[model samples]
Target chain A: MTAQIIPSRTAAEAALAEIFASAKAGLPGSGAVEKLREESFAAFARGGLPHRRIESWHYTDLRALMREALPIAPAPTRERRAALRKAAAALPANSLVLVDGVFAAELSGKLPEGVKVTSLSAALAEDRPGILESLAAAWAEADDAIVSLNAALMRDGVVIDVAPGASLAAPLHIVYASVAEKPAARFSRSLVKVGAGACLRLNEMSLGAGGRAGQTNNALIVDVGEGAEVGHTLSLTDTRPGSLRLETFLVRVAARAKFDSFALVTGGGLMRRQIFKLFAGPDAKGTLRGVSLLRGREHADTTLFVRHAATGCEGRQAFRYILDEESTGVFQGKVVVEPGAQKTDGKMLAKAIMLSDAATMNSRPELEIFADDVICGHGATCGGLNADQLFYLETRGLPPPEAEALLLEAFANELIDDIGHADLVAAYRAEVAAWLAARARSETRSVA
Target chain B: MLEIKNLNVAIGGRRILNDLDLKVAAGEVAAIMGPNGSGKSTLAYVIAGKEDYEVLSGEVLLDGENVLELSPDERAAKGLFLAFQYPVEIPGVATMTFLKAALNAQRKQRGEEELSIPEFMKRVKKAGDMLDIKPEMLRRALNVGFSGGEKKRMDIMQMALLEPRFAILDETDSGLDIDAVRIVADGVNALRSRQRGFLVITHYPRLLEHIVPDTVHVMAGGRIVRSGGKELASELERTGYREYAEEAA
Candidate 1:
């Protein structure tokens, strides 16, 4: 299969091959990583593309979308630049911007003390300890054409790790910004490690004012350590129709460690966010929550897989989506309790509120348990506002339109309040209200 | 100031209120005493212009304006308020915010300017104090995690804030203790005036004790079967709705 592929004449793929040659020059990582890359490239050559039949990529069929290879476009010139910097202003970091899978060092900011913000190429060139092998082995799937393309073509993706027990106040931010020109595909990854009792706040802003057709972005990793606390917040809003496919990998919560992630998807052409959090240590816990607001033909998919490998671990996942117009929403969540994971408690709630007949929501919640002593539950609700509830509000003198707003606000408000950050909650409420207003206005216009 | 002529209402094709007739003039506090399933709530809701009641036939005239054609918000603009028996809570929306929105909505409909934030706050603060409601409760989400008594208090507070020309109290005393009932009663009484009318719906006469009414109507079989003065409520309290239920059957 490997020999059957790898020889294709396309402008982008040929350029990717050249970039691969440059990335291989003076690579710093050991022969172990070189062999992994060789195997991954070979697998990618053979597999060619992943189809919808692939169970893991059922919701996101990357094979059909990647029919033509889209290589990393070069960085912006001084006079003509995209809004990458403006979109990433919220994340405080030794910030790095990857445009079309290639890094722009000039666009990145300075790193803080004891923090090294450099490209994967630089890390490999320097043979950085604990940087290359773990992620390459764990996250790099040889068959994923996109991840493989990222590995084969990505010149710079920020890699930061905290030495054992070393704490830093500022986080290392990885910003993914897109601009509309041809088919844009970018593969990016971030490997973060925290020390015992250390804390970090990673903020990712997936933003763009507008884009043309054929736009794709894929991101793969983030880690929180034992006794460490990490808070991750992402606000993703795209202009026009584009696709955002991201896989978040989380491991390492020693006893008493904590991880909290709050993801907000304002609107995208199509967004599928997968978060796989593995709680392997006793009392190692985490909370994951997301809100995806969609309108137009935009679609948002949030898939979560949380595994409780140790006893006395607590995990929670709650996500709310408001789909209007002809938009589609999908949520698939699973909480698995392995054997001997006694006292493992988990809860997940996925809710989708549709405002129009064309709006559709698909939700599935699964639980697998081997432990006799555990409490795990998952529930999903898909519907319009309640008739009794709407009548109740209308009876209070709210118009039918305002009544819908009140109900949706009431629904999303449930999760918004649980967001620990007050400022973030306030901002998110405004986002929800704005989306509702826009949806209401557009819907009214169409009705009229 | 309010009149319902030949009112008929149905829920999912089942008639709940059939050809109901009632009237409430200015300065009237009319008590509607009814047994279970007597469509007391249906009457309150239909008159308040709630959706799904399916008013099959009727003319609801509020101060000579045909209200059956108007939205509930429009009725509210015309000075009609329905104190929900079980008020629907709206989380993330503060009580003060709702009050402000409602107040401004009514004012705008009346061609009046919106109250400044400070002015609105002062007005709410007055009602909060008059109703003995904690100021903190106003800051919280509307009735979220509120006690039964507090929810009713919130309803009264909103009623006081809107200051409608007519109001419907739908079993507002169902879940209140004596003290909370007194507070709600006092709040309702404070809004009472010679030009404002109120229709108080209750199954228990306990509420009438706190807020005395001018007249009491016994609703049986979805219609008002008997009419009398305040003494009628006391009579029903002495004798349960069994007599009305027997007659209804």
Candidate 2:
């Protein structure tokens, strides 16, 4: 397994320390939360940003991916901000629109009944301190550098609360559209707190629309309450078709909570680290499915971490990628079982199909277990379509190119078939098939 | 007519077929009985234009045209078909959709319009029934997860749909039971016409009894060293390719 993260950023480090110092100096609190934040900030100061040396962040080299200057906070133009509204409107569910790391309330649609949606800004104004404090407590340790950096850079996000016994008819779609110039990195933070026995379906669309700098990143945090079920599907990519994006999603499930997530990635010039996480609670379920179809200079990275912290919880992750031309893909999934988290079942598999020699894929699937009674496994496979299989199709008279596309489609079909929603599955299948067909045509044209 | 004249082939720098020769007239079925490594399957693949099954020498002529210049689909459009012994189990390529594509491709090459969904369904249903394959089989990925017999039957069903002028059955009877063999043989017999030819390649001679060939050739050491009437199959059935292989060497 190759490690891609390294830490040596003095400039970014100085910026982080100043941000933490301000956060400590201007503590917002009604109770002991201020002291906790001070302590977490101190830990952050000591640990600094996590490098690849830390086992948790093996594949995604955040330090290298950051490259040049981190774009300072800036308001994207109103003209370009239309993409946020447009994406939100296309969704068939209640939407929370966030533009350039800031939520646009008047631009968003009406919230569904029994759904309590509040901006992070509004929640802080009322001094409901525990919600924000608990978030820092659960996800960040001053020792956890990335979480602290996110905390320091955190801006406007939506907080969704589902009342007890409520089940949403339509899934909630949170559209985060980045309007910043090229290299615009939008830090989008979302916290979903579902009440016990509540069921919710959420769709997330992460778009780096028309950004010049070529990269945008968003961070989302979701917590499924006890016995609540949440399904989140993300159609993630950049608007410019050849732009790069870095996104991180942190999801936590409570006792009896169920979480299902699907990520369909296309058209990112350089995509880094869309992470799926399940901080296990008793009987909690987490299933992650992702597919990245990239061509040209596009790059997609899917990294998953599922910590089995409670007993009888299930964690499953599957990611497949198709890369043509000079596109690149990276998939790294790790499943960890804490001691006494027995009966924790986990399965992670990463499969990649490279259509051209110029395209590249890096995959590492690993399992860490401390509990003896757990059933945990991981698999990673990378290759082109099987010649024997293709020959079989060819003899059936599907030419080589068509046969190759059919086999690649079949690779994604396995994951698509597992998606419970029929219509959504069909749409994704059609989209992926078309993407593969276009590549097939291009290759054939070049050959001819 | 299909003819192989001094066909020489190799794979990964090693010779598999050397100076091979055979012929099958239109409307006639010829059975090639050979032992493992006798290049029977290699011959079929070379004719079908499988990647890396290079033609080092000799020529394969179909209807008086050298076939070595054609691609797989081109060969198929030119009235040549090779029924793979080990049918690929493609996961997403629906059996019926693939059949339609193959059929339509051949039709388009012949200047005919593509089949509509309804027309395709009707034709596939008839062909499926003739091969004793259920309609559900057509809905599934082409031959994926199918039994060996089912895979062979699906191959025959596709062959029936294409209705090519020449067909090569490479061990189509290798994995089938007596009943599946009979059903497959009956389907092929039903589709036989004076304008088409078939070269059935198999290790065992049992298949020749039902699809009784017009001629039998014993292939050994990559070439056919013996040819005779249909009764030759019974002789090889009692003995084996060992004698013929020794004679060829």
Candidate 3:
């Protein structure tokens, strides 16, 4: 028999292994949760970092891009905490703040009636009902190594609960902030549970302190109860170079429930946002929209998977990307209609605009319909801005730059309007405007 | 106000305008009547500084400045306008937004302050009313889902708002009903002034009946083959362009 051979581990894998070994005891969990973490870590170890060989990760080679995993970030200093608190105070009422993946109770604001918020660590220690099961549910999928890793290294986050029949007056804001002065990493997980007949609006915003090139892996789980209406928005803006982030959203829509999620990503070294949604009960409706604006050498990937396990469900996914300079964008969406899920209507579309020759966009939309009476379709289109549209605007006295900006803004803002919250829509538009403004400045400087 | 001297333009090495020379002086409304493939639209586009065609050798002067070197927007600021035969449908951009942007951009390029909301609204309301445009239509995306008549009326409204020193209406009457043609013509007549010149490019003499031209030119194979008084338009409508097409060949 020949001698056994073992390939050497990648730098990131080795660093992750070391970090897990040293920090295992300090991780927030009890016996059952600890076992679940061990099992997840074991699964991750068996698979290693996702690579092009993995069908879902065809466009992103995380093992190669994540060269070395940085150490975990430490607790914030008093000054930094105070600064973050002041910043959080200025956000909308009923806000929750997290610093370096850990919940900052002092930074958060008061919650409204019929709503409760608790730190994920406390929930895990107290063995909250269904919390452990929720964390492990996603592991059943074969290509969930990233989610498994997040589970193993998860530190702290928040668990929000909305009471039954309660209608929230204001949206709940969750701000994920990183104030690390040096390269580090953070793993956080949050859950939102909307009870039956309740209505809730949630906003997730991630802010990275300037000059900090850190890595973040956060998971958000949303469970929409029967007849619940939930609107969720995630806006991620981090311009720091060398920063890498991976955010996973797991959403479940129950009977007659309506779930809408919008994600906006701009500026960051390397980013991957993957959403997994399931129609768990009949007559549930789900809508997912994502917009990514990338420039410079930034790279952003948005992947979506929707599983229709219940009959008479409707699902729609629309994504848009605007790439400039040498930036790259990728969109991968897959919709699966289970064998018994008849009368299911699902559609997925991804459209991208490449501004420069050096820029690149990859889109893949797939539909797997096992039911005979279901209507399911997928489409993807990638191209540069329309020449005729640009010329039309220019002929109306708008310069080339101004014309381009207007078209680009319109392209991105069209989806922002679908968020349904007037204030949030305005905020998202301002963010898009700011990104365009920055791009204009860079273009002018290059021309000069 | 606008002069084209020996303007030879080609697209992809195929000549569209062959040594074409035409001039429109201030206070003059010149009409160009031609058959299909006569390059009437090409002449209008070239004057508007569209980049699709290659100018082999020519000079397009607006107010004594060679507009060939200026961009399309710059040409617009220099008081040049072209109402396209087919107005582009731009989704996601409201008609009012496009109008406001165009008006402010032109003003800024001319080093003039932008109009306030009330003033801008007043101008839009006045021009839109003349074209029979509904306020709801202005709230929709520019030219998107608009009928042919509505599109033509929108272009005429834009012309009224811009008040260009010289305007070229390229086949503006095509695809329009008789009622639309009359409405569009009336809108153009309201903008007519001694200081502003107009070039009405069309095949039929129906539009000229409303906005009578001072000079009428017949074009064939890119160049103007005949020029005469307003009666020239009526003559072409009766005699047809078969002779001019053969003459150019």
Q: Specify the highest-lDDT model's number.
A: 3
Winner by DockQ between candidate 3 and candidate 1:
3
Each model's DockQ? 0.56, 0.57, 0.74
Residue-level lDDT of model 2, residues A383-446, one tens digit each, is 8878888776666566666767777887877787776777667767886777777777888798
The numbered model that scores best in TM-score is: 3
For candidate 1, report its TM-score.
0.90
Backbone clashes, each candidate: 4, 9, 0
Candidate 3, residue A14: the lDDT equals: 90
Model 1 CA lDDT for position B127: 89
Error of 2 at A290 (Å): 1.7
TM-score winner between candidates 1 and 3: 3
* Per-residue lDDT of candidate 1, residues B88-154 (tens digit): 7777677776677678877877889989989998998998998898988988988889999999988
lDDT of 2 by residue, B1-249 (tens): 888899988999888887999989999999988888888898889988888887889989998899899878778888888888887777777776677767876777667898889988888888899999997888888777899999999889888888889999999998799999999999999888898899999888788888989999888888888899899999987887677777767
List iRMS (one decimal) for every candidate: 2.2, 1.8, 0.9
- Model 3, A32-89: lDDT tens digits are 9999888888888887899898989889999889999999998877777767766676
Candidate 3 stretches greater than 4 Å from native = A1-6, A141-143, A209-211
Best-matching candidate per DockQ: 3
